[model samples]
Target: MIFVRLCLNTIVRRWNSTELTKVQMPAIMHLTRLGYTYAVKFHDNQAGEDYVPDTNILIKIFKEQFERLNPDKKDTFNQVLKDIKMELDNDDLGRSFYNRLVSVSPSRLIDFEHPNNNVFHCTAEFTCKRDEDEFRPDITLFVNGLPLTFIEVKKPNNNGGMLAESNRMNNQRFPNKKFRRFINITQLMIFSNNMEYDSEGGIIPIQGVFYCTGSKSKSSFNCFREENKGGEKVAPYNAEYSYKSIDSLVEKRVLTDFNC
Candidate 1:
């Protein structure tokens, strides 16, 4: 009787073990496939043909632009920028962004991965199968294990080009349910025309986009939330604001919030 009981216990343990393996093995395999692609594209000795833009270059531009701005305009500009940034940093955005990039929690990911995991040597672009179609984002932001953000950048002089790109990005067909299932884990969707900044559903045109410059002045940042038609809110479609304000929003972890 004791032997029979022991055998039953062993079977139960094995069943539980199998269940756990079933859940974790697929993710491990999927991540491994992603890793393989990452390794091939980012080999150390690649030359000019393999180069990608340095994100730090963009950051440097923001810093330099801010420094170059006139001092009298800095205060108001800084305040508005700071407020918008704080709004973006709220918990919802941060968690969604972190989850999308890290695969696991950001803290644990950092603990297990190398410090430079999030920094890629080059931009790795690929087309993955989405439903029955193929879809690709212009750039994928990677850390060590997973993609953090999908960025679509447009040249500053590309008249109406940015808008076109934005439309493509927000298209449901691009991030089909399957792709969304894979990338929904990501944090933010960034659309920049090298001139304007915008995000999902805050205000349109006026409130939706901002001009990003580094100048320090109230004029550097403008809100499109003002009333235009007899106290009715006017939506400024493509007005520009300082890029500094946009950078502050990103740096301060404003886009971290997922809540609308």
Candidate 2:
């Protein structure tokens, strides 16, 4: 747990699945502490109180980040915001949104290692509501106040696998408008459970959906059972596939941003 804390200092505290917090999410309060957009959370003209980004703050982050990457493209600001809003409302998976942001210039939109050249913002357990279907997830990772990833945590190996559900929820929900607007700029949709040991026969994978904690994932054993092997057979964890998806998006973001 300490390793997790060291690796990811998310704004929210440790989450309890059984005891879901009906109260306000901690991220809403600590966005500034965790380095939110411009080191400031959103506020409105009517009332000067900390709140999530409204349309203006969202557009401001886009403008500031865009200017940082492509200073020559100020003419595209209004149209870009219009396009971004349309993309956010229309595209459920945020593929188009990701492309629009990174395709403008060749610069890092999110850099943890670079203090000055960073636009990425990460928060957890923030409330996102669309029409009718209001579901609160465990975590939401953001870049420049634009969400980039949605992570759902469950008990150790709560179900059989996550690849199926991740696909279903993220890819197939386009037909249902109610669920589409909740996620924005999402490059990765991760479903992970705690480390679960196979009581009958031990398996190498006993942790989250990702194999490694810091931007790497690999599995030693295969998921399938070999006839010759005496012990229970295991197929390769699906982490490789997930990693490839994330990597492809990142690569595209870079190439498009650089105009290469």
Candidate 3:
């Protein structure tokens, strides 16, 4: 957890972003009309009142992208979300979702990259619920009010392995489950520890083939093995995997439509 925090803080200090600690998911769900306006229909626990927005800002972005992805079809936020969910529901076409996500134009990132852009928000130990059950990831990243990446941190040595733990979190733990509505909208999935790291979703695989939903661990996961395959030393897909701390890796670049 410390290592991940170090990386996050490094990026936060270097880039035009803000990191919030001791924040609840409800607070993060609603945007205060600063850098980005998500306008999500968040259940307001603040002031013990109810607040519902008419449109989801992130979903609106998706709707625009979907319209661009299919110019012939008329797009609505609900239909756009349902279409992505349909592709997401299919195990074989998981990478299609990643392709579409990355294909989103940089303009849609929403006033990012400026000195006061403030589109990216990072929080530690945020609680999210799937129906009545709740889980807290080590870190949750929000881009323009969209909770895009979820990071699960662990100790050096735990259960089966980092891969096993990541698989459990990615596929079993409220994720890919109907009740966990939040996970359905999430694009990037990551798991890390001091000794090992793995990331999936959001970005396409270097090998050019993404993992099937049913085959989560097979081709999708990229680990920092650095082993020699066929007498050639293999490197992690993204150089950031090898980097202890870098501004462009997970934070600045992933949020933008740079196609890294």
Candidate 4:
């Protein structure tokens, strides 16, 4: 009788410890600690409860980073916007993503149709192909004359491996669409989540998707190739990339490389 009781007690203790470990786990995995200096520097003191990033700030960052990268690409901005619209029109998911992406920018204040205006309006639910269902994306990014990039964001807490899932959705929605047209015009695709990074640099990959993160050090930016032939150090398709601080990206003018 005593032996049976001891066995039962051991089983109960192990189960209790497992429950405690789970209780202590964070609600969200892969939480990133924002650099304190960057937080302080970018702090907004405005009075409204609806604090958001100003469109001018985005424009400034793009101009500074993009121009520094591709000084020759200035005339193509309008064309880039058109390509974005074309892609979004072709896919329902793209349309939805575009709507959310715009909300984060201050340029949302500008009416989309004024000629020479710096902001463009987009439809969240629009019919593109004849006899096809209406489509939507999470957000659409537009400038005065062109659709720039389509941003798709997922909250990690709501979905496991949300970044990978979002990328899958992007492929399904925009497959066979000419990324080159947009890439030629805007320079890159930004696929980011609240916690991870997945991007396609302007170049085509012979292997996996090319990725980059915001970094203070230029040397820290590196690319990874995906392969079925595995090695111990090889990361799975959904593995997280260490992100460079957003502050470093802004300060370094990395986007300016596209403008050249």
Give per-model TM-scores. Answer: 0.34, 0.48, 0.41, 0.27
1 or 2: which has the higher lDDT? 2
Angstrom error at residue 192, model 4: 2.6
- lDDT at residue 161 of model 1 (Cα atoms): 42
Model 4, range 1-260, lDDT digits (tens) per residue?
99999999888766434422221111111111211111111123421221122211233333433343335765554454334445544334344325633442322323344434333322111112222322232333344323343433343333433335434434443343432223223323343334423333624321222333221112112334466356535465434555434444533331232111
For model 2 the local lDDT of residue 170 reads 40
Predicted structure 4, TM vs. truth: 0.27
lDDT of 3: 0.43
Quote the lDDT for 256 in model 3: 36
C-alpha-based local distance difference test score of model 1? 0.36
User: In model 1, what is the error at residue 237, expressed in angstroms?
Assistant: 28
Which regions of candidate 1 are displaced past 4 Å? 1-107, 112-124, 159-161, 196-260
Candidate 4 Cα lDDT to native? 0.33
User: Taking the candidates one at a time, how many backbone clashes does each contain?
Assistant: 30, 12, 0, 36
Worst 10 contiguous positions by lDDT, candidate 1: 212-221
Q: Whose TM-score is higher: candidate 2's or candidate 4's?
A: 2
Model 4: how far residue 70 lies from native, Å: 21
Candidate-wise lDDT, in order = 0.36, 0.45, 0.43, 0.33
